[model samples]
Target: MESFTESLNRLKEVHENEVRGLQNKLLELDSERCRDAQRVEELCTKNHQLREQQKALKENVRVLENRLRAGLCDRCMVTQELARKKQQEFENSLLQSLQHVFILTNELNRLQGENEKLKEEVKRLQGPRLKPQCREGASDPPSPLLLPSPGARKAIKEKTLEGQEEAQDDHPEKSTGHRTSPVAKISPSANLPETRAPDVSPQRISNQLHGTIAVVRPGSQACSPDQGPPNGTP
Candidate 1:
């Protein structure tokens, strides 16, 4: 009977300990549910603030798009057309300048070629081989013969006349047979040297002598001793 009573007491103590363990488990579950509910509330507040920010951003985007459609599109089109025209004008001017430069280059090349040709021609003309040919083609003119001047011719004629006067003086018979006039008796002098007068021809001397003889007529007065015969008498 003592053993039976001791076993019953032991069972009763185990039941009490099990009951305390279940109560502690229920308190832990309740604390976990309360923490979950507080976390849900904080999440809901953050979601509401994010929705408000999204709506404000959408409104701002819509206003900006409307302004772009109203005036900005036309302004951009006009600016694009002006830029295209300026670019086309620049291209045309560049093309014209290129053509002008090409023309000038061609002219310069032609001038340089002509200059080279002229230089070669000048060198050919100045060569030594051409000198003898030029001299042969253009021969030197014959030299003129030297002749006596007018003063020398007159002195020769006077010397011839004096010689003729001396010849007349040597032949007195011929002088007496003649008119004995000073002009008719003229003859060359013996004291003068005998020399040939190349300038005075024989025909010219004979004509002068005949002219002097015919000029003195029988009744005409003789000329003065100082005066000489006129040249036109011949």
Candidate 2:
């Protein structure tokens, strides 16, 4: 009975040691769980702070964008107003220039009409005396020998000399060539008075009257037969 009591006491001591070791392990696990809970709470707080900062940054950016758009619109309106003012000034200047040109054109037309009237008045003043002279010239007989140009007179003289030479050649005994040349020379000298006379003809008188009619204004009177001659003519 004493040995059995001693064995029961040893078993009781081993069981008590195992119970103490299990109690210590349970205490260590409870301390580790408390530290993990504190770390999880700190992470949640930091995430909430970061989300609040992002919201503030987005609101500030939107305000700045709105201000920038308003500034650009104001500048555009100012530039368009300036362009419209310049266009108005250019149109006003063009209108003034056109008005000045129109006034100058009217002045030029008035001066041209006055100049034409002055020319016609001058022609009328010189027309009356010219008509009487032309009428007197038209009454004279026409003569081919009374040519106005020196070249025509010279050519006619040459033809007359050639005819005289031919006649002298046909009648050689009637006159010597040397004597006939002196007669031809004397004949020109005798006709010098007639050559010096005025070259008056109906054609020349008609041409002068036509020129006077063309120069005289339509308002002037026509020439009359009863009109007196000029002081220079008979």
Candidate 3:
């Protein structure tokens, strides 16, 4: 009976130790589960934050895209309007140029006609005239002396006066039929359509509107000393 009691006490001690170890393992497992739960909660919080950030980012991207599209559309409209205005201006300029060219061409044709008429008149006047005796010797009966019509005489006198005036205006000196000064010749380039003088370069077009004339200011030097001799020199 004493041996059996001792063996029972030993068995009790082993069973108690096994129970304590199991309890400790259970506690450890509980702690590990708590840690895992905390980690999961942290991951969930991070995911929520990330989702919020993504939502904000998407909203910002949408806003930026809208603004960009609006800006692009506005810019396109501005560009189109500018192009339209430029095209209108160009067309208006072209129209004005055509009108100017037409006027110049008409003037040129009229002048050319006048020049041809003057040349024919000059050729007729230069030809030899028949003497009175030579007309008498002709076998054909003499025609009546046909005096120039009053209107014809008046027209001739007017033309002569106009020519004299023009000559005087051109040469300010005793009229020699020969041209003393160089004739003002228009260059072929001058016949081109004229445009509004570029605002930045007015001098390039100055010669087109006004013939070449030497402009001198009050204190400026003259082109030739001969034209502006010493104060008392003849």
Candidate 4:
């Protein structure tokens, strides 16, 4: 009986040691489960962050595309505007050039006509003088007198008329034009030539050609063969 009891005690000690080992293993397993749960929660949070980042990147890409499109449109508009402005400027310059050419052509034509008329007048005046010069090649040079200007020519004409008047005064029978008062020489057609009829008669017209004025008095007596001058006998 004593040997059996001792064997029972030894069996009891072995069972107790096995139970303690099972309890320690259960605790380690529970700690490992808690750590795994935390790791899973961290993984979930990282996934949510990645999803948000992807959404933001997509929005940025969309914004960039829209900006690029707007910039391209602006560039096209600028180019078109520049082209239009250049075309307008070119047309304006061309128009101005044409106008200038037209004006120059008109002026050139007018100058050419004047030059031709002057050339004809010079030829007419020089024709008689040139013939004599051609006949005598060894003749002495003429004096270097200036061609008469308009004012000088008018003075020369007045002197000629005065000389002719003096010569006519030497012969009373051939006297034509009579000198008149300055008041009588006033022109009636000073401002209204178109409204008045010509006060012309055959004798008055003939007298005008001789630088004379003829006046007709009202109720003048007709001259006959029996008439005599007031200062001379008939």
Candidate 5:
């Protein structure tokens, strides 16, 4: 009986030591699990911050795109308006030029009609006429001077003087008299005289020519040729 009691006490001690070692291993495993959970939480917080930064960057990019689109639209509108204004200005200039051309055409036609009438009058005046009266022989009446009418004679004399003045104006060295009057510089268009024949003698023709010249040249103090001959003349 004594031997059996001693064997039972040794078996209880071995079972108690095995239970204490298993309890120590379970406590170490629980501590390692707590450390792994803390590391996972820190990683999640970093991921959330990265996502917020990405969203903000996307918003900024959208705002820049909108501003660029609006600017492009404004620029296109300005360019179109400038083009329209330029087109309008060009049309106005073309209209004014056309009006000017029309006015010039009318003036040219009126001048052409006047020139034709003057040519017809000149042809009529140049026709043949009766011979002059001579005193049996006075060198055939000095060849029957082809005298023009009073008005026509004045016009011819004026035209001749104008041509002389133009010649002098062209060559300053040939001009010996004073400057011509502004009226004397009238264009040939302004000098077109009325067509009419008048009874005129040679002396009368000379006088009328002299009068027309006096209109062009002012302050004439010279004596007329009909006033009197030189003292020695008969």
Candidate 6:
């Protein structure tokens, strides 16, 4: 009977210990549930803040798109205006250039016609003076005889002065060889020395006389005093 009573006490102590363990386990589960609920509340707040930020970002994108469209339209209009202005300026410049070209062409044509007229006039003027060879538009160098020598002008002046002095000594009352002075006076050529012309043959002279004339100076023809007839004679 004492052994049975001791076994029953031992079983009663085990049941109390088991009951305390179950109460401690219940307290731990309640603490874990509270921590999970607090965590869920914090996550819900974070999700609401993220949704507000997404809406703000969407509104900002809409504003930026509207500004970009307005800017593009303004740029296109400016480009069109610039293109029109440039085209107008180019047309004005081209028109002015064409006018200048027309004016220059007219001037050039007038000058060419004038030049041709002048050349024809020169030919017409030269027709009468041209030689047979020259009539064909051929030309010869000028003859050395046509151009005076360097000393020729000086010699001609000296001779002219001497002739004038001799011509002034016309004495009507003077007598020569007991005969009275004739009405005809001694020519100025009497003061000059006797000179024969160049020995060119008559054939050569006739040949060279073509298309040219021979010239003799006035007051140069004179008769020698010895060859003069007596005064009052025929």
Q: Which number leads on lDDT? A: 1
| Per-residue C-alpha lDDT of model 5 across residues 147-202, encoded as one tens digit per residue | 44465455556655654565456533333344432222443422423322121334
lDDT (tens digit, per residue) of candidate 3 on 87-127: 99999999999999999999999999999999999878765
lDDT of 1 by residue, 1-234 (tens): 899989988888888889889888888878887887778787788788888888988997887788687766657879989999999999999999999999999999999999999999898877876789668645754233233344434544664676466555653322223122222233322112222222223343454433333333333233332233556343
Query: Compared with the true structure, what per-residue lDDT tens digits does model 6 show for residues 95-200?
Result: 9999999999999999999999999999998777776656454354333334223343344444445434544563222223333112112223223333222222
Q: What's the TM for model 1? A: 0.27
Report RMSD (Å) for each prediction in the order shown: 27.6, 18.4, 29.8, 21.1, 22.3, 21.2
Question: Positional deviation of 56 in candidate 5, in angstroms?
Answer: 18
Alpha-carbon deviation at 57 in model 2, angstroms: 14
| Candidate 2 lDDT by residue in tens digits, 1-234 | 889988998888888888888888888777777777777788788778888888888997787688687675556778989999999999999999999999999999999999999999888887997899778767755323322234434534554465456555653333212222221244443221111102123322233232223223233333321222333232
What local lDDT score does residue 32 receive in model 1, on the 0 to 100 scale?
A: 80
TM-score comparison, 2 vs 3, better candidate:
2
Error of 4 at 72 (Å): 7.5
For candidate 1, give the lDDT.
Answer: 0.58
Rank ordering of all candidates by TM-score, starting from the highest = 2, 3, 4, 6, 1, 5
Whole-structure CA lDDT of model 3: 0.56
Clashes of each: 11, 0, 0, 0, 0, 0
Q: How high is the lDDT of residue 6 in model 1?
A: 91
Better of 1 and 4 by TM-score: 4
lDDT of 1 at 5: 84
Q: Give the Å error, residue 172, model 6.
A: 73
Give candidate 5's error at residue 137 in angstroms.
13
Clashing pairs in 4: none
Better of 2 and 4 by TM-score: 2
Candidate lDDT scores, in order, read 0.58, 0.54, 0.56, 0.56, 0.55, 0.53
The segments of candidate 4 whose C-alpha lies over 4 angstroms from its true place after superposition are 1-72, 135-234
**Better structure of 1 and 5 per lDDT:** 1
TM per candidate: 0.27, 0.32, 0.30, 0.29, 0.27, 0.28
